[model samples]
Target: MFGWLRRKFGKTDRFARLDATQFPRFAPGTVWLVGAGPGAPGLISLLGYYGLGEADTIVYDALVGPDLLAMANPRAEMIYAGKRGGKPSPKQADITLTLIEHARAGKKVLRLKGGDPMMFGRGGEEALALARESIGFRIVPGITAGVGGLAYAGIPVTHRDTNHAVIFLTGHDEKGGVPQAVDWPAVSTAAPVIVMYMAIKHLGSIAEKLVAAGRSPEDRLAVVSNATLPSQSVVETTLADASTLAARTDIPTPAIVVVGPVSRYRQTLDWYTGGENALG
Candidate 1:
């Protein structure tokens, strides 16, 4: 099942050298929620790798890449509970129920999610449901796309020269519309940089709100798609034109949108597949 390890490490027991005690066993009857990291399999944490190798069942989200899934024990039960906006997806409650059912049956259950499990991925909700059922669980954090994806796009979330403070926000609410709770006036001037997750769908409305709340319409914004993967693409625009630019059907999803001067850093720090983080 861990054939990748043999292919990569060539039979070296690296774990033994690094202290085997640090790599904890994936005990049966406990559920582990692990972030698979933005779209790349290699970004998965060590604990995540261990959990995959030992898990009896893996309940994975839509954004979790197939490469990461290929690392799991071949005999493990794989459940797809991916939630794509506006698509037919499994209900959250039912997915949690699956974890509880698997754990109660004395199986090593793993919840594989994209980005940080707790960052807009609904990992907290699932964990709460598991706790209510008295099912033991662990959280293995990974690089969130809001942070890692921007880095791949060569845009810093925060820079000493530009923004000293930053805000992370989800673009939509339970109804899948622009978040009504965001205090537009307060947040518009609150942080130097604002990173929005899943906001592309409602960018036109959101941009209007921010501009009305004192944010400059000409503020820089970049949309990073399929982050950290070879297929990744960056679209740069001003907040004034963000809606019109994102309106193109070609722009990919599972994207992170950044608003601020941080995106301008791509001119220098960009190391990923890039020509220019500028609008064509």
Candidate 2:
């Protein structure tokens, strides 16, 4: 009987980082890392909704949906921590420190981020910082860009016949340029559906690496900008033509690139092409 108990309880420490009891109760002193989903307010999960309502202060990014912010308690204080590549913004360390300070004050702090907090949202850094300070916090997952944004553009990451696996990768590194650590050949051969974030600026070099890695130039590719938002736009092309098409257009950051046979689904499944909606 003791052996059985040891097996069950010994594994508990593996997930101790996310223990709910370690975190303060939802009364008035707690911190929640809430994902606002990818651009759309309706895409936010119920857990995100609950965190917003209980927030005493909300530190939000620029990408967060405005409609979602409206859901926050009327008395909640809002702080802007939006960071854009090549633009001036608050330092990440500063943001993390602020979260710690807010939580230490015994306030219900909500660090609202766009897309899933753990997916390229830098939530891990904040969580680590919080843990080091011995501050209790909770992480609430939301729809990430690779999943939610592609859906809004009528592109599925995987299709039963086309692909059984998908891979989400960032185009840029901490310095905001193409990442050199990525093994192009391995990724090219392994992942049928490849979605990139912040890679619009380096699309030319990225395409070259994939091509050298044996990814066909004719492979279907789609770039969805401002995904899931009213101002969303999509540029459809092949891997070889993607860089050229992007250069000629104004598609900016907050974009997602999908490459694979699954991209062909956009032709028929795209509901945003009717021009009746805000997406161009």
Candidate 3:
């Protein structure tokens, strides 16, 4: 009846707006908070795929891979919201405001973040800001570094003998420094395995804190640089030697530090057995 009504009203199609009603409409006033997953593009969730297709504007970060962006509609607007520590980058508030502005302008906004938006990705802040403005939003979760990166390295976070539990911590805090809020003593004592993100520069302080917390000086540690990338590198060290090991190595930023018994598994589990040709 509605189709006939529309056609009788001189519309070319039976239901001109059927597409919007049938498909998950990227409503003009809503923002889709999407996770791009860890470096691998195939790891993105189905909702992420849909959001990319439906979005009119996509605001992405540095960690997001280009493959995921390629899935966005050709006509979709793309914006870079990368925030590198110690580098000139866009403010968090500004990024949040951009989403609001795009949605207010009747654009379907996609706020794409790297890894799981809730896991150290700061998606909560953006969601809160959207809520304050009465903007409708959706969250699409993605695989986080704690699991995805470790898988690429062929290291299982939980092994029957090695570890029953794993703890993930950010090396950088709100100010992008080694987070002082973490109780190193408690973490070192309780967690069987520790994955530290953005803590390369502060390895010295972190190692010292771990040692002070009664962790063995020779406790195994592995720093996996550029995890899951072609240029990835892994260096095996110990709690006491972590600072020196990292300082001597040419590993770059965006590395993951695995500490505890699990770190020892990388010695044999590291399938990327190629020699250090680039570092040479």
Candidate 4:
């Protein structure tokens, strides 16, 4: 409703009203593991925005978009430690060491990641390493795509009529293959809604396993690609067609997969169309 106020005042004028003293100072010689949120630059938390303005170094990932990085302090060093399909991602140990090196040098370090830093982003591992080295750090949470992205697609992750519970899992393990540890049988029945991150590569196998383990082949599934971005798109399919869909479609990376009746909401609840708010 205040879109006009935002348009009139703009974010710059609005930002002037923030009470900086209320926030913990981003001191030099410390690191902050900040989640960049799903995809939208504006989704970054206020604390995250504070860190971006104060940090001396931004250790960002592939999912950290250029627009988001533009918010950082002009003098902040930008370090790319992202995993590309064909190129080698810097070693975890190396990334940890880098954070430590910069922190020890008395720099305010921002280990910026896509989505919640703690959720599958390996922020815990880096935190552990930092702890061992006595490096002070903080965790700044952001919205994960599984929830925010699904909402953008008009799919509520939960609904009283459909599911009392939901499940979240990765499609691949440390070795970048289908996780061998998931007990498909148990997973198939554990929740009415299943959300998979980084699962597109092995989605065919995952869909097959779920179907074989008692989940219906006809269950609704939504493949949300580049979720929350202007280019975001959702492919409504079923477990039976998941494999074929995975093989035939060139869905973008950084996608989230949803299974169960929650996807049925997309037909009516979809409020984002061609990057515009459908409710408008």
Candidate 5:
């Protein structure tokens, strides 16, 4: 079954050549929730790659890279179910229903999401929906942008000399506003490093909250845009100036915001922009 895939995509540098049978089969009438990783197609897992090759229908998000999508069987049907903040996107209910409908039709449905499906990608909700409907499903984890994207930007989420703990949180709640449940003061003080996903839209407000919570105005912060992709860009700034600096830059969304001293390590670890340094 993997002979064709090995013949076609096995020579890629990022993925080691291996038998496709090692991965889970994309059974008929079942949905596979896969993470495409940040934006780099090569970051997709071996299982995810196999699912792409076998899926009969692919329901993908806005952040899934084109190269990854191109790996799907040409005869497969592609459906766009992207959800962007403040933009017109398919309703979550509708997307879940689409997955169920396609699976019920005896098609091998692949719900390809950007980043780790379970990590802020709404994979839980979708999985729950499939469970309620008694649909068989499998999860193929992908590198989430929060960590992988930051790595691509040369920012380590953790460094022994800098931090021992990290916190990951989304910037907005369901209503497209700053999350109200988070204890801003505790987050500001306790977490040595904070990695925020989908926080660019409300960055200014979030920054303000952090500042009011006792985080220093000059705390190092880095905003990595289009992370892990060739078009990626990193903006280094401080907590107080993050909103102003980001506003003046052309960095695009689907970005990750990292806070802490670990961001400073980018100066020596920026492999994409800077040559290899002694740090790594």
Candidate 6:
């Protein structure tokens, strides 16, 4: 089956040369939850690439890149299940039902999410739904934006010289407000580095909370937008002025906000900037 796909596409690059047999089959009547990686289609794993070629139905999220979608079988059914903040989106339950519906029909279903499906992407919720219905599914991990996106901005989540601990959290809860469960004061002090997803909306309040919780106002931070893609842009600022700077700047969503000393390292390691510092 794999050989036939390669021949049909008439491509012999490294991706096409991969032995699909080495990976789990995207069998019929099963759903595969695959991550498309940050913003780079090339970052997708070989198993994820194989699933794209075999799936009869692909249910993808907002952040999944067009390049990855284009790799799907030309004849495959495409379903949009993207959920963006402050935008009208599909209900999570409905998406789960859609996956179940396709799988029950004996179709090879692909649930392709942007970034790691389990990392703030709601893969666990969908996976639980599949389990409750006795549906067979597989997980294909991808590079999460918290790490990959930061790397694109030349920010490391951790460094030997810097602190060892890091924390990843969402900017909002299910209600689209600051998460009350998180002890902001404790987190501000405990975690040496913090990476926030979907936090742009509440950045002002979050920064205030962090500041009141003992974090230094002068702490370095960066906001990386369109990470790993051609239109990628990064904004560097201090925690004291993160909210003000972000509002004034056009750095768009699907962005990652990184706060820590590691942000300063971007000046030295920003490979994307051609030896120039990415700090703004």
Q: Against the hidden reference, what TM-scores do the models get?
A: 0.93, 0.87, 0.86, 0.93, 0.93, 0.94
* Model 5 worst lDDT window (10 residues): 12-21
**Per-residue CA lDDT of candidate 2, range 22-59, in tens?**
33356455679989999888888866776776689999
Superposed Cα deviation of residue 165, candidate 1 (Å): 0.8
Q: Write the per-residue lDDT of candidate 5 for residues 218-275, one digit (tens) a residue.
A: 9988989899877888888899997796566476887899988998888778987563
In candidate 6, clashing pairs total: 0
Clashing pairs in 6: none
Best by TM-score: 6
C-alpha-based local distance difference test score of model 2: 0.82
On a 0 to 100 scale, what is the lDDT of residue 277 in model 5?
A: 67
Point out the worst 10-residue segment of candidate 3 by lDDT: 271-280
Per-residue accuracy of model 4 over 109-144 as CA lDDT, tens digit each: 999999999988899999999999999999999999
- For model 6 the local lDDT of residue 181 reads 93
Q: How close is candidate 6 to the true structure, as a TM-score?
A: 0.94
Global fold similarity of model 1 (TM-score) = 0.93
Q: How far off is residue 186 in model 2, in Å? A: 0.8
**Whole-model Cα lDDT per candidate?**
0.89, 0.82, 0.81, 0.88, 0.88, 0.88
After superposition, which runs of candidate 5 have C-alpha atoms over 4 Å from their true positions?
6-17, 275-280
lDDT of 3 by residue, 1-280 (tens): 1243344346767445543554356688799998888777778886687678778999999998787787677678999999888799999999999999999999999998888898888899999999999999988888887787876776788899988888899887897777989988999888778888888888878989989998899888887777777767677878999879757648776788888887556556666544332232
Q: How would you encode candidate 6's per-residue C-alpha lDDT over 2-59 as one tens digit per residue?
A: 6645666686664444663577767899999999999888899888988998999999
Candidate 2: list runs displaced more than 4 Å: 1-27, 275-280
